[model samples]
Target: MNFYNIVRVSVVAALLGTSCLPAAAVSPPPARTSAVTNEDERLLALFRDDQRREQAIDPLGMLYRTGKSDPALLRQVFTDNPVRALNKSVKLSLSALKKIDRAKLSPERQISYDVFLYDKTEEAFWLRPDMLALTQVTPLDHFGGLHIQFPSLMAKGSAVSYDNVADYEDALAVDRAFPFVLDNAVVRFRQGLDSGVVTSRLTTANMIAQIDGLLAQPIEDSPFYSPVRDFPDTVPMSERTRLQKAYFAAIRDEIYPAYRRLRAFLNDEYLPAAREQVGILGMKGGPGLYRHLIEQQTTLPLEPEAIYQLGLSEVARIQREMDVVRKEMGYGEGDLRSFFDTMRSDPKFHPKTKEELANGFSAVGHRVDELVPLFFNHVPRTKLLIQPYPAYREKYEAGGSYNQGAPDGSRPGIFFYNTYDLPSRFLTGIDTLYLHEGAPGHHFQISLAQENTALPDFQRFGGNNAYVEGWALYAETLGYEMGFYKDPMQHWGTLDDEMLRAMRLVVDTGIHFKGWTRDQAIDYMLSNSGMGRSDATAEVERYIAWPGQALGYKIGALTIQRLRKKAETELGPKFDIRAFHDQVLMSGALPLPILEAKIDRWIASQKG
Candidate 1:
C-alpha cells in the first residue's frame, strides 16, 4: 500500500462519505447568505480557496512519502493550521444553511441542503466540547514526536524529498490532521512503551526477528513476496535508486529505533499509568471520545451502547439463520461450531496456486457481472480487475480488498487477492467475495461516488465505514438473488463469511472495549467461525490495533438489509430491486441514517 493510500484511508475514515463529485461541478463557491455579512463570506471564500488549493496540490498530504525529507516544505504545509481553516469553513457552511429559506431553494439546492445537513451533523461529533481540547493536543504531539524520532527521515534533506518518500505519510497525516485523535494514539503508544508492559528490548527483538525472518528467505521463495525488480519509469533512475536506498535505510535506522523507543516507553511508563477498565466508557472524557469516533466514522449520533446492543441482536439473528442453513445441508445433527469446522477443513474448497487464486477471482467477477443486471440498472462504468496483493503490504492487507482507482481514470479499481497463503484463498466463497469486493459492492459504490462531480470535494472521496462496508456486506446477499449461489457448499461460504463478520462485532468490542485479552478474542473467533488459528490471531490483533473498524462491516450490512426490507414492505408490488439499488448507489455513500432517509424517499417516489 502506498503511504498516501494509507492517509487516504484515514481521510476516508474522517470524511465518511465515499463518493467523488462530478468534475463539471467542481466550480466556485455558492452565493453568500444574508445572515452572514460580506466580510464573513469573504473570509470563508479565502479559507475555501486556500484549502482547496492545498487539497488539489496535496490531497493526501504527509502520506505521500517520496523519501525526500524537506523540512522547509513540511513546515510550510503544517504551519498554516488546517484545523483553523476547517473550523472557519464549517462555521460559514452552517451560517449559509441557516440563512437559506428552505422552502424557496430549488430541488437541486435542496439536495445540497440535505448533504450539508449530514455534513454538519457529522462535524459536530468531531468538534464536541469535551473532545476539542484533547483532539487539539494529540496531533501536535504526534507531529512533534515523529519529527523528533525520525529526524533523518522527516528533516529537510535530499533523502526525504518527494522522489524518495513512500506514500504512507498520508496515513501519518491522518493523525496529524486530527491532533486530538493522534494525541490519544501517541499517549497510548507511549504508555504501552513506558510501563514495562511492552519493553523496548522486547519490541526491538521482535521487530529484528521479524525482519530477519523476512530477509532469510529469497524473495521468490515466499508466496507473500512480490519483487519490485525495477522502479516505475515515471521515476528517474537516479531518484529511484536513491529512494530505494533511503527507504531501506530509514526502515533499518529511524523506524526501527523509534519502534524500540516506543516499546520501551510503553513498557516502562505508559502501561503503569494506563487504566484497567475497558470500553470508551471509563476513560477521561470517554463519552465524548466515543461520540467523536462514531461521528467521525459513521456520521451519526448513535451512542456506543446502542451500537453494542445492535451487535448483540445481529449476532443472535445471524446465528439462528446459520442453524437453519446447517440443517438444510444435512448437518443439523452437529452443532454450528462443528459444522463450521467441517466446512473449513474441506480440501475441495482450497485453491492450489497463485494463478488459480487469480483465476478464481476473475471467474467470480465474470459470474457477478452477469447477475448484476438483475438488481442494478445504474452499474458503474468503472472497470474492476483481480490481481495479487503487492509484495510490501501483503502481510497487512485483509484476505482481499477493493482498491478504488483514481478519479481521472489513471488506474482501474483493483480487487487485490492475497495469494500469499493460497489455501486460505478458498474457491467456495469466491463468487460472493467478488460481489462484495468488486462489482455492485465496494468497486461499484466507491467508483460511482468518485464519478459524481456534483458532490463537494469533501463528499467525493470521503467514506463512512458503516455505509461503505455495509453496502458491500449487503451486496453479498445479492448473490442469492442473482442465482449465483447454486452450490449448497458455495452458499455455506457466504454464511461462513457473514458469520466471520458477525463474530468480529462480538470479539472486537470484547477485546478493546470489554477488556477481553487478545487470546480471549482469538479463542472466540476460532471457536465461532472455524477460521484457522493463525488467521484468527492476526484478526484479533488487527482489531486491537484498529479499534471500532471491524464493527462497520456487519453493522453496515444489517442497516442495508433493514432498509431494503422497509422498502419492500412499503412499496409492495411497486418495489423494483434494480431501481432500489440504483437509488442506493446514485445517492453515494452516506451515514446509515442518511442512507435510510434517502431510501425512504426513493420508496415514496416509487409508490407515487
Candidate 2:
C-alpha cells in the first residue's frame, strides 16, 4: 500500500556479474521522442519541466519517474520544501495547461492533456480548505509518512547509490536533509494538533516504536550508516576513513538526534493529543475527507455506505469459496469461526523457521514462472528477487509488497516478504502472496509499463491505485488458471488473501464511516477471515492510518475482472488471453473509468 518502499537497485550487478556503470546508467534512457506536432512538442516541453519538479520532490522516484534521464539529478538530493513545492507545481502546471487549447491539439496531445489535467485537478483538490485542514497537518502516519521509508532508501543495497565518492557525497546531502524533513513533520503534527486533526493513538505509538528502535542502535549499525559500512575499494583509504567518520557524524549527530526529537515530539506532545478514535470522520472535517479519499483512491464516485455494502457482499462471496476449501478437505468442519480457528492453529499450516517461510516465497515464484506461458506471452525482463522485509519496516508493513526495478532491466524487482513474527505467518498463503506481489503481479504490470518507452512518461510512471492494486488483485486470480489453487491448501491461501481485501472494504468503511472503533474493526476482520491477530491488527491500523487505500485493491480488481467478463462474453471466440492482457497492461495504469472506456473500446474492436 505504501508505494514508497519500491524503486530497487538496478539489475546490472546481479545479471551481468559486475557493474558496467552506476545502476541508473544501465537502464536504457527514455526513447528519444520528438513531438508529433507543434502543439504536442510545446506540451511535452511543459511535461518535461513538470517531470523535473516531480523528480526533485521525490528522490527515490528519480530513476523510474524520470527514467534516470538526468545523472546530475542523482547528484542532487531531495528538494528542501517538498510539500510546498508540490502545491505550487500543481498550481503552475494547471495554469500552464489552461493556456493550451485542447481543441486545436492532435488527438495524442489531447490524451496527454486530459491525463495531466485530471491528475493536476486531483492534486489541487487536496489543496482545498476542507482537505488541507484535514490532511496537511498530519504529514506523517505510521504508514504513509517519510519516517519509515527514508531509512530504507538510504539503506545499503537499496535504491540510493553509494557506489562512489560523489554518490556518498550526494547521499550525505540527502541524509543531512532528514532533519529538515523530520523537523517539518513536527511542525505539521503541531499544526494538526492546533486544528483538531490528529492521527489515532495507536498510530502514534507505532511511530514512536520505530523511532525508538532507530535511536537504540549504534550509529555504525544504523540503517543510515549502511551506505558507509563498506565503501567501494576504488576509493582511496584516506577518503574512506573520512567518509566513514562523516557518515558516523551524520547518523549520530544529525539523523539520530532528529529521530530522537521526533520520538520525543510524538511521546511528549503528539501522543497525548492523538485521538483515541481511529476514523478520519473522528477529525474536524471527517465526512468530506473520507469522501475525497474514496473518490481519490477508488477513482469512483461511490459513497462509503455503497462501498461498505459492496464489501459485505464481497466478504460473503469470498467466505462461500473459503467454505468450499474447508469442505474439500471433508471433515467434521465446525462453524465458520471454528474453521478459521482450525486454519490458524494448525501446525502444518504455518512455517517453522523464518528461512522456511522465505524459501516458501521463492518456491512460489519458481512455480509461478513455470505457469506463466499458460496465462500470456509477454513477461517482464526484470527477474524477481524474494527477500524478507527489513526488520525495521516489517512491523508496520503488510505481509508482502513489491518494489519495481528500472525499466531497462537494470534492477531486479524485489518482493519484500514479511518474515517478522515467523510463527504467526501462515505458510498456506505464501504461494498466493508470491503470485500477487512477485512475477505475474506487480513485477509484470509495473515493469512492462516502465520497460515500454512507446508510452508517455506520465502513463509509464504515474498510476491510480484502482488500476495498480486492481491489477495486482486481478493477478491473484490467475492462480486459478495456473494450477496453483489445485492444491486445496494453496487454494485456501488465495481465498484467504481475497478475504483480507474483501474484509478491508467492510472494515475500512466501518472504521471511517460506520463509526467502528479500532478494536471493533480488528474483531470484524478476525471473525471473518483466517488472518492472525497481529496481521489483523496491523491491517486495521493500516486502514486507520491510511483510510480508503485498502479499498483500491478489491475495488480495482473487481472492476478489471468484470471488464474481462464483459470482454469474454462480447468477443466470444476472439477473446485472446494474451491480447486481453496486453490491452489491460500496455497503456500502464489508468483511472478505473478510463480503464473501462479503453477496455470497452478494445472489446468493440475485437468483436468485428
| lDDT, candidate 2, at 183 | 76
- Residue 149 lDDT in candidate 2: 64
lDDT of 1 at 595: 73
For residues 1-608, could you state the per-residue lDDT of candidate 2 as single tens digits? 42512323211111111111111222223344454666666777677777656545444455333332233333222222444666787788889888887787665456667767877787677656556667667766776556776687667766665667877887787777668657766876887788788888988998998777777777878888887778787777789889999999888788888888889999999899898888888877877778878888788998999989989998999888888778886634587779888877888888889889877887877788788887777888877788888777787778888877756676677888887777678988987888778868888888897787766677676767777788888999998888888988888899999999998899999999989998899889889998888899888988888778788889999999999999999888888888989888987777888778878878877776
> How big is the positional error of residue 284 in model 1, measured in Å on the Cα after superposition?
4.7
User: Best candidate per lDDT, number?
Assistant: 2
Worst lDDT 10-window in candidate 2: 12-21
Q: Give lDDT tens digits, candidate 1, residues 63-145.
A: 22223222332332222244444455566567656665655554334444566566655555455444444333222111112
Assess each prediction's global lDDT (C-alpha) against the native: 0.54, 0.74
The model with the greatest TM-score is 2
Instruction: Note the clash tally of each candidate.
Output: 62, 4
Q: What TM-score would every model get versus the actual structure?
A: 0.73, 0.91
Each prediction's Cα RMSD? 7.5, 5.7
Worst 10 residues of 1 by lDDT: 16-25
